[model samples]
Target: MKSLLFHRLALSKDKKGVLELSEQGQEIQKADDILKDPYVLEFLNIPESYQFLESELEEKLISNLQHFLLELGKGFTFEKRQYRISISGKHFFVDLVFYHRILKCFVLIDLKGGEVTHQDVGQMNLYLNYFKKEVNTEGDNEPIGIVLGAAKDHVLVEYATESISNQLFISKYQLYLPDKKQLENELNKLLDDEHDNSASR
Candidate 1:
């Protein structure tokens, strides 16, 4: 999750920019593996049709802390929400913070309601640096970052409000934010397609 969770295609590449995040001498592929692909949020119970604010999503996840931890895998313990840090005298806040017992690192998460930008990744990197310098202890591994984001398709979103003769915007709105099952299906399909493409290449 060090990068913006790009749209459901689960693509590591951004349509707009390249995301390179390995420290020299580090195994790049394993670094990629550090991020849980898809970072499942079925626990949040957000309907696929619902377009939500990042704050709202954060609140839901915090409320369902147990389920959220389960999705994050073992060893994650919630530290704080809206954890703050000061840099050059300016204060910055990370959305959600956790400590991974197994990884021996701080896991910083920034929630994005829409597609993630290169600037977002840079921002997370800055958070990691801040923790490395100011927060983490000498024994801790480098902090891990995740930009949990929705890789929403603009085309579908733009047309979402548009309706044919049979239905109105209200009807369309009700159908927005898909149910968990449909969302999972969509995610799996994208993963499958990506795997197929990679295999062929």
Candidate 2:
């Protein structure tokens, strides 16, 4: 699925002359770059523009896990929806849990209905710590945590993630699907901008 998207964009190399994708997978990108900023949730039956709660989005994604997985990127297998982990004397549930085959790591996702916060990042960080120490096996890789919010604040993300050891990320979610043709056009524009920058340098 990821290959299809890359091929359609006719991408070869970026301004840095590095392949966007290789046999291993998306190269050495930080968690933020590794994850999509505005994840499209077109699989849900909601209208193109509609108000919804975090639970609503989560339920819709769970109802259509197959489509959700596809949008989630490649090599992802659904492990558990609303996965639970016991901490201290209390039980906490992760909104979604997926395992990435190629990456060989557990992917934990937390959904936010509105703006993301430092608290959300801290919660996900705690989840990562627990998964790494308790849930993961000898061969398991360190877990990756993602906090998906309806709105994004770059400043908040930078401040919240600073000094955090976990590979945590925060990104926005879009309720509607993007037009493929429109996306292609945007890709071309990006390529053109890259070319222009390279020429200037």
- At residue 68, candidate 2 shows an lDDT of 82
Candidate 2 has an lDDT of 0.78
Model 1 TM-score, 2 decimals: 0.61
Q: For model 1, what is the alpha-carbon lDDT of residue 48?
A: 78
Candidate 1: regions farther than 4 A off? 1-34, 152-201
Cα lDDT tens digits, model 2, 1-201, are 533444323332342322444444555333443566567775687885677877888888889988888777766788987788897889989999998776778999999988999999999999999999988987778889999998879898999999998889888876754568966777788778879989999
Q: Could you give the C-alpha RMSD of every candidate to the true structure, in order shown?
A: 12.7, 4.3
Worst 10 residues of 2 by lDDT: 9-18
Please list the residue runs of candidate 2 whose C-alpha ends up more than 4 Å from where it truly belongs after superposition: 1-34, 177-201
After TM-score superposition, the amount by which residue 192's alpha carbon in candidate 2 deviates from its true location, in angstroms, is: 8.8
Best by lDDT: 2
Name the weakest run of 10 consecutive residues (lDDT summed) in model 1: 166-175
Q: What is the C-alpha lDDT of each candidate?
A: 0.63, 0.78
* lDDT for position 72 in model 2: 77
Give the number of colliding residue pairs in candidate 2. 0
